[model samples]
Target: MIVENSKVILSVKNLTAEVEGVQILKGVNLEVKAGEVHAIMGPNGSGKSTFSKVLAGHPDYAVTGGEVIFKGQNLLELPPEERSRAGVFLAFQYPLEIPGVTNSDFLRLAYNTLQKQKGLAELDLLDFDDYVQDKLKVVEMNPSFLSRSVNEGFSGGEKKRNEILQMAILEPKLAILDETDSGLDIDALRIVSNGVNQLSTAENCTVLITHYQRLLDYIVPDFIHVMESGKIVLTGGKELALELESRGYDWITEEVKV
Candidate 1:
């Protein structure tokens, strides 16, 4: 269980954002402490995915107002690459395919880039091969995956597993998995959720952006929040997820208005 006294790792205050002149996030405020797992759930168009992208410094989204502070530094001030190097990882819902780049090469490049940024020793090909092999076990992946092009011909589950594999190798402080449960089968979901649960620690945090409560069963969150109209309308504990799953989100939205 996460303690309340843990230091805040992420602070968002009245964060408003837009994409292509359309406002998506309206004054979103959230605080994430070390060791905490936060689940953001809502219906379609509630801006759950947008919040994840904005945190990662996506180029298309414009920050119209407010600020984000991560690890005592201005997060919005950092570029996307800097954000990743600074230990902020965003796992996209639809993992992209890089047909030309080998998976091992891609992971090694990313890991080495972060290592260099932190003044740590860079791993050579031989060293990285040994290192990544251990991480592949986190997702039950085979060595053959390392030789294949990045997500080139991978199935949906394979792609998600590859994303988690990257997260394991990078070891980010705050990992935001945006709808990772999407398009996954029971077996795939279990593998992905187990990987996530194993990776979460007292020193790191995870933010899960999802619509279904089923994912929460495997990787339970310390806090569950409901998003509506681009804002976090309600926050609660794990039981809230069960409530949302049973009764739907209308009751919460209606209560908020009253």
Candidate 2:
């Protein structure tokens, strides 16, 4: 039985989805509780990105079966915009650049758009600006980020930090990050991870989808799940990431029947 007010915030049961009629997710199941970080580690072509996309209501993929419940709500039934308004946040691997959209304009609209969905009043430009300045301090980001177009001409490091900055401001109940450690130098990784860590609280959860164990060192997920062929084959604590790093995914691949 699933509880409406349980500590588990998101419940995914026997989830199966597809892209253009080709099945991608084959009965994937996961349970995420508040304040917990779950790292999904898998090899390339293992359907990690598919899982992230399906959760965000991307139309390119179709749900073949299963249920996704978020805080007692049917998540799959909602549209992508509604999904964002309802608290699902996905940080993309390759962020698109909008040359005309100012970063500050985008952030302000995103924050207030969410606020409106919750039946709360929207924050004016002044209030939102103040809030953004404070969040930038957390990532050691500069004020110049506000004036630039959204992700336009941003370095790899700047783009990742910008994603974290949005996460910090939106404060979604469930945040799904896909390969966030990619293209990041040591300093940028530290700054981005630090921002992510600071955003976590007793009321929110973080889900990291990554291929390498290097990211686990900074984020320190509460659970590590190994995915192969769209299903979780192994699960353990932080040490599992280390073990995978030592022995490699070969152990999991060899054990899994495919």
Candidate 3:
């Protein structure tokens, strides 16, 4: 469903950021258009995660320079909550477990918050339950999850599925999944990837930050970007993933040094 010449959903211009006074993202530039999926890949400290966090407005990371424009607005200007309401979704690598909040309540609150942003009526409990049931199917999650605490006592895969459920309900214009494939078994990976694929559409953009190419096997990206020392040193078509898998990142890093 990728439309050629679609509107740009995210634009990062010479972005530089740091955490705890140490630089992470340096001179990073990327552009994502509607309907396109992009994957960011590199070694452990390549700043792939930092880029995603900075996009989500993580306070820990300070933007020392550059700008991020989302949907034609200065992305860095909006607070975190406002970013979420503006249809920016970030599925964390490690989703936190809330001990007291029930899944149903948390999901409803999030959905209603977005509804309020749009000046739409919020769905009540019964109506919301019906609405959520449909969204749960996207992740093939069970209704029993609603009764449990948000991500509490859930398996790793279940936690990831829960994140996807949130994405299904919110239907954000831009979805940034940071290392979502981490700590997942084959079955879990397949299920989660399928859920992500189901949620993708012609009007939304997906950015996946991953290490292994296996994840890309399931959720093929239109472009694959390689980050080295806080910069996107290389970008290519889906075939780049296979090359990286076969040759490892040494070639890419070495080429970057040239």
Q: Against the hidden reference, what TM-scores do the models get?
A: 0.98, 0.96, 0.99
Number of the predicted model whose TM-score against the real structure is largest: 3
Rank by TM-score, descending? Answer: 3, 1, 2
User: Measured by TM-score, how close is model 1 to the native structure?
Assistant: 0.98
lDDT of each: 0.95, 0.90, 0.95
Error of 1 at 172 (Å): 0.5
- What is the per-residue lDDT of model 3 for residues 7-120, given as tens digits with 9 covering 90 to 100? 999999999999999999889999999999999999999999999999999999999999999999999999999999999999999999999999999999999999999999
lDDT of candidate 1 vs native?
A: 0.95
Of candidates 2 and 1, the better by TM-score? 1
Rank order (by lDDT, best first): 3, 1, 2
With a 3 Å backbone cut-off (N, CA, C), the pairs that clash in candidate 2 are: none
Candidate 1 Cα outliers beyond 4 Å, as residue runs: none
lDDT of 2 by residue, 103-152 (tens): 99999998988888788999898888888899998788998989999999
Q: Candidate 2: where are CA atoms >4 Å away?
A: 1-6
What are the per-residue Cα lDDT tens digits for candidate 1 across 1-258?
A: 587699899999999999999999999999999999999999899899999999999999999999999999999989999999999999999999999999999999999999998899999999999999899899999999999999999999999999999999999999999999999999999999999999999999999999999999999999999999899999999999999999998887788778
- How far residue 75's Cα lies from its native spot in candidate 3, in Å, is 0.4
